[model samples]
Target: MLKVHEIFSSIQGESSHAGWPCSFLRLSGCNLACSWCDTLHAGDSFAGMSVADAAAALAALGLPLVEITGGEPLLAPETPHLVTTLADAGCTVLVETNGSLDISRLDPRAVAVMDVKCPGSGMEGRNDYANLDRLRPRDEVKFVLVDRADYDFAREIAARVWTRQMVHFSPVPGRLDAAELAAWMVADRVRARLSLQLHKYIWSPDARGV
Candidate 1:
């Protein structure tokens, strides 16, 4: 069984799949308390359901793409099974994980969008750098930058590790301006994409269920 916070259909808000209709299964609970986390409301409250039920819920949404996210989905032991279930059922699955946990165990068929916590997030120490070695070309590395220092930090990592996979640098909403971040990326000629939180623009930043 898995502890589920909410299941809803929305546009893929980030990463290479942005703007596509997708189903999101947000699981509850997290191990790290990042300073700028937007989903604090999902911390503890949840409803438990078997993997079969959760798969049914997402499949009912009729979207070909699905993302299993969380307060930190990797914290839940059943997540790998859930990912496999969804993929076997013919849905494209994405797991958005806080980079602290080991992602090597995830179903190879599901794309893993791993977030390497930047210094600005206040949880940088929690990042498992070993996860970098485990990333497949289809996976993504994300850095949510809050300032220039964070950008530099992400650039350094991308320089050393990024190859066929995409490296995304997203400015923390309201903290760093998107245009400024884009300029810095261009000036440095960094091999990374600028990701904006699309749902926040389509709906209010705090709007629920997209």
Candidate 2:
């Protein structure tokens, strides 16, 4: 069984798949506590459901795009199974992971959008660098920045990976100005795409179920 936080249809808010109509299955719990975490409430509550049931419900959403996200979905033992099940059902599955866990075990049909936490998150040490080798051509790397220090850190990583796959640099809205980050990227010619949380702009940042 999996402890699921919510399953709802919403526009893909981040990553290369942003703006697509997608269904989200947010699992509960996380191993890392990033300082700027927006979904702390996910760990505070959850409802247990079997993997089959979870996949079934998501398929019923009828959206071709489905994402298995979380308070860190990779933390759940059932996540890989849930992802594979959905992929088998012909859904273009995207798994959003926090870069602390092993991602190679997931089904090849599913794409992974792995977040390489920046120093501002205070969880950089939790990163498993080995996961970098596991990223597929279709996979994506994400860095959520809050300060210049975070931006510098992400810049180094993006230089190495951006040429091989998709890399996104997103600023923590209140802490770092997007325009400022954009200017820095322009000056440095950073090899990454500036990602804004599109859902936050479409609705309240705190709103759930999109």
CA lDDT of every candidate: 0.93, 0.92
Candidate 1, residue 188: the lDDT equals: 93
Clashing pairs in 1: none
Candidate 1: regions farther than 4 A off: none
Q: Write the residue-wise lDDT of candidate 2 on 131-206 in tens digits.
A: 9999998999999999999999999977878889899999998999999999999999888999999999999999
lDDT of 2: 0.92
> What lDDT does candidate 1 reach at residue 133?
91
Angstrom error at residue 88, model 2: 0.8
For model 2 the local lDDT of residue 95 reads: 95
Question: Residue 49 lDDT in model 1?
Answer: 98
Evaluated at residue 60, the lDDT of candidate 1 is 92
